[model samples]
Target: MYQMLVDLTKPKTIRGHVDVVERSDAGTVTSKGKKKKRSRKKNGRTSSGVGSDEKLNQGVDESVDGCTIGKLFVSNRVIAMGSNGTIVFEGTYDGCRVAVKRLVKAVAFEVNLNLRISDNHPNIVRLYGTESDQNFWYLALERCTCSLNDLIQRPTVSEDQAKEVKVPKVMLWTDKGYPSTILVELMRDVVSGLVHLHGLGMFNQDLKPQNVLIFKEGPLRAKLSDLGISKRLVEDKSSLGDHATGKFSIPIPIQIVYCFNPIAQYLISLAVTGCGSSGWQAPLLNELQMRAVDMFSLGCVLFYCMTGGGHPLGDRLECDNNIVKQSKVDLFVVEHIPEAVDLLSCLFNTVAELRPKASEVLNHPLFWDSDTRLWFLHDVSDRLKLEERKANSDILKALESVSSLAFGTKWNRKMGRAFLKHIGKYRQYNYDSVHDLVRVVRNQLNHYSELPLEIQKILGPGNEGFDGYFRSRYPKLLMEVYKVMHQFCREEERLNKYFKGSVV
Candidate 1:
């Protein structure tokens, strides 16, 4: 694509600067000028509401005209505006949207997005090109509507029904968003976006739910943007060591009822978020495991959107995934609760691979199981109604039965110890001795769910599956193992209470 970094501070044109002119086979360029325009309009400034057509009309004829940077002209509309300090216009370039950003900053560290994009992924925005002059830096980027955090804060969908009449209710960000289709679509898109980034050998150190957006839901397209803090995964000298990096917050509402007496506050802190607006950031995220961190955020997002409620684990107190595992998401988002449940099931897996990858979600099977969706839509509200009146003591009766049946295996093993042993034995293969084995599992686990038929027979099996003899008979055992570790968290809580009282 054609791109240029024209100096906006020019008081004179290219015709006046013979010595500073940069001539190429394509065209002539010059950096010789007073470098400050009399009016902001001349420098590519305009009100936020101003359309691209109006903004383009005020400048030099030699500036970006139509789709062409220097010669081409075509139809592409500017879909978004950048920060207030930058005069930017974005449009479809060769069928893909591209942002043409140019502006002056007093003392901002210059960024070159393209150099790092090859190693970046779909969830992380790509930077294609940049141009610079004495007074300004020009950047051409991929464009999307806005941040995912921006979308969450705007408005959510709620239902209202009155005696034979049903109507759509548009609600501002208060814990939930539109029903099933939107949430599933958002999840699907975000997963695909994440898969793309991981493909480039990069890790999204800041993979919060709000950083994801469903730009095109019907087709299930998501774009991961905002790379100011994104870093490249490579064998290079440049590494991100908190280079002014901050995080975005999910606009889902807060459940302040959680914060009551001091004892309650301690308990509430475990279940609720300390971040503003009960941000969907996972509390354990601060531990820096860097393994399955994004999955934690995705699970939290699913919890909020499906419930139209506040943060999960409201009455609990903990920072680890154990609290997340024990604290269930309470809303029964009727239409797609099953699908939501399934997504959350895979997302919160203690073992990252067993959890669904963002790519696998492109066409989730839950979409095919029409019965589950219908069941949720019909029963969820009734259950909630019963809950509101405190009449739903039996609301989760069937679920409780299922859990009892599921947990019966507890007699066979301790949750965390079994998995720890499983990992120990699994590593015994391909090792000369126990001492040489790397604590890390070989990367093959990434392809666990998507193994080709040729490799499946050897790696995966049934009636307990090959994992029983290899990893573990029931893969879900890992969650149980983590649960065992989570049990110890109460000891920490007890210690915390004692410390809080004793501290002088």
Candidate 2:
């Protein structure tokens, strides 16, 4: 899939080095610098009269040599069409390829917002420059291979293609869904972008798979795009206050009603309503105009990615209804990935204040690799052992929670008689004691290589060995420990000093 994107975006020389040219009216110019007049219809309107605001040759000119808008030479090939009558074209800015978004009914506010937020951030799409003419506004942005929506909806690779490609060690792409590793990485990127936005006192009101653009460069990178409805947290106080008090208007453009089909118009209306896309929006968005709304939408987006397009609340038709009713989320698809379940649980919390910040979401263990997760668990185990006697209420609660959810009663039964000979009464292990369970796991991890060959086979194979074994069998163990540790650290400031530099 990534290889296909690479092929699609590989630069093609439309025409040899062409100089930038200025034009007073909407018309195409040849590579030799001769202006070609656009054809007009019998009614005096342009031939391609898609909308009243759309100019035939302003941006989407069907010229063999392509047309220049400011410094950008926009190709006639339409990359995408927005319901709001905006057109995105494949274009060249300076020497680099870019996505040229031509907005007929130009919104000056959106242009300024993009310019303000798109600079010096890897995860936010880069804006090269902006241009305008009598009829349209053109924005030259970083060209990504495809949107995350396109990637998510793409068909799985054939057996032949799969056999030809060497999948990465971290990635696990099955016929059922996308690689868990890829989903985590892409989601981390989205969260990173959101952190940047929230840090700058802005919130992306509309965050969905379509708003996340994918760059298939070295590693597949995800960048947040489409900040058309985004708002600055500090500047929009009055509007946000109105939203909180349930006294806000959607601000739908009057032009959109005439241009799009009924279905497209309905979708567009929902999108630009300032409440966010139906399924991805938080339930209390109308009552709470805060950054946490973005987190709820992010959780929905993450759920979609992890489940291969399944929405947590329900299908698209039912999502908004379910959200309004505060219905239970359908989490069956991600049940195996406990970390994801835990993270999503927090993000999906109806209480806006309880939702984690973007930075906290980025630091989740769901994004961590096997080795890092093991190291964290090992560190937590050591801390628990050292602080057992002086453990706080939070620590005790965490310990009790983990013990109740132990992997099994006979945890050491698989280790064989010889392995347990060093320790007394190892036959009937205590599943009720967190200390015993932690000690057993720690010992197995600590002496994995020294364990007998049969015992090692029982644990599982691979470079990760016991880490992978435990992760597959008891995925929630790591999450439970992390929760306890996090709670403990938050309560005990002095104890947090020990984990100042710890990997979360």
Candidate 3:
């Protein structure tokens, strides 16, 4: 839907749309116009961008208590949170000790993707009710004190401190010692929660330390909180009209706003997007689009955890820029300086391709334990050896012949020779090693060639000046040898066909 809303910042009418056609306010709504700029992470750097839009409110409201939607009360409970005030309330619901929430009054929802959370996913914060009669609307929720973000802020913890302590997955790498079984299990629950949410086609668009909570008084479980901006993937919503109304008679066209069940409100300032901290956004979310946004956030969260809350990407990124700023496929696994550096390099890449996928990340060398690491190394070595054999064979044949040279120009000849020397520069005396390296180079080349011309230019082919400089540079001898081998194979096949010789 085309929404012409006044840009509260610049005071001009700007347009935006929902990715899906929506008929009501609760339907999935995304902007329809030009997209906002997204920041990036590269090198081992961080900035204030991570916590840029954090709200300044303490959780203290007696309007509604735990599990009771319309219940009212009054409380002076106030607690300190990361640079803000937090409200803590204790109450009984259904004869069980329950914690209730009191957060800042929410004017807009904060998340990148679109998904609705209606009492789904066990690890997610369950919404019990909302209060909307008077001064302000209050969201009543089951409370927990352990935010992953808060846990990571500690300066450092000794191995013993971590023995039974549950740490966020994002901070696991910072404390090298293996997390306790309970910790690992809890982290896996977090992943499982994500899997469940995503499986239902829902994306927790807003993910950060604060949004992820660990239950302090029960089960030692982690739960995702904050659904202010959660979206629900709906079918055709265009029929609901330009201002489709849903369960609470809310306007449908505005994209950034989030509500559980809301009443009508004239569009004021557009809803603000909250990309938890600069280091928190993911490489995939540079554009702040939906699925990719959540993916980008996940990457950043992973980086922060590995580095013990250290920021990976410095914060901002231009759309058009080289994706790879690190050596090897350090897209995942960020431990030690190199791992963190590599991951920091890729986690917030302006381009989504530069970031590793969830599957690749799960099995990355950085996450692998000693056993898995050894196995990965072994597999990589075997593949390299097979490649080396092919390289050596080509080199040997090239060293033998002179010139059929249908390819290079006089200028090309000089450049090609230099290319050959450059290629051979990693002087390995072992023929097997030479062949393996050649194979590796070919695989890398093929991978690059398959990418778009635009992407290739940014990544720079790693071929340096070698790619087009040589006409697929041949060891003059290898060219001749291949020709002969081709003829011999053909002749042998012909003979077999005619004489009924061996099929081989």
Candidate 1 lDDT by residue in tens digits, 1-504: 122222222111112211111101112222322122222122333323123433222222223334333111121233334443655553322222345555564422323432244324544454544545566555545544444444444343332211111111223221223344444555555666656655554445445545454343224334665433334444422122233222222223433543233333333443332221133433332222332555556566556554543345553334333343444444354322334455566666555435554455444433322233222222332333343465544433332333322233332242244344444554442222111111112222434455555445544453123323322322222232222223322135322221121101
lDDT of 3 by residue, 1-504 (tens): 213221111111112210111111111212222223223121212212122211101122223222222332212232222212334344322222234344444442221111123345677765443333333333334545456665665447664443324333243321233333344444544555655565555556667666777664344566776654544434522111123432123246642343321211111111233323333433222233444445566655655555456444442352111222211223333432332344345545566545443433333223323333223223333433433467455433442332334222322244334333443554432322322333333543545566556545543444532232221233222223223333333244322221121111
Question: Which candidate gets the maximum lDDT versus the true structure?
Answer: 2
Candidate 3 or 2, higher TM-score = 2
In candidate 3, position 355 carries an lDDT of 49
Q: Rank the candidates by TM-score, best first.
A: 2, 3, 1
List the lowest-lDDT window of 10 residues for candidate 2.
18-27
> lDDT scores for all predictions?
0.37, 0.63, 0.37
Instruction: Give all candidate RMSDs, comma-separated.
Output: 19.6, 10.4, 21.2
For 151-227, candidate 2 gives per-residue lDDT tens digits of: 66654655444323222223434343434567667888898899888888788878999989877657877889888
Q: What is the lDDT of residue 66 in candidate 2?
A: 48
Candidate 2 residue pairs in clash (backbone atoms < 3 Å): none
Stretches off by above 4 angstroms in model 1 are 1-111, 114-128, 133-136, 146-179, 208-210, 214-220, 234-280, 283-287, 308-310, 313-336, 349-356, 359-504
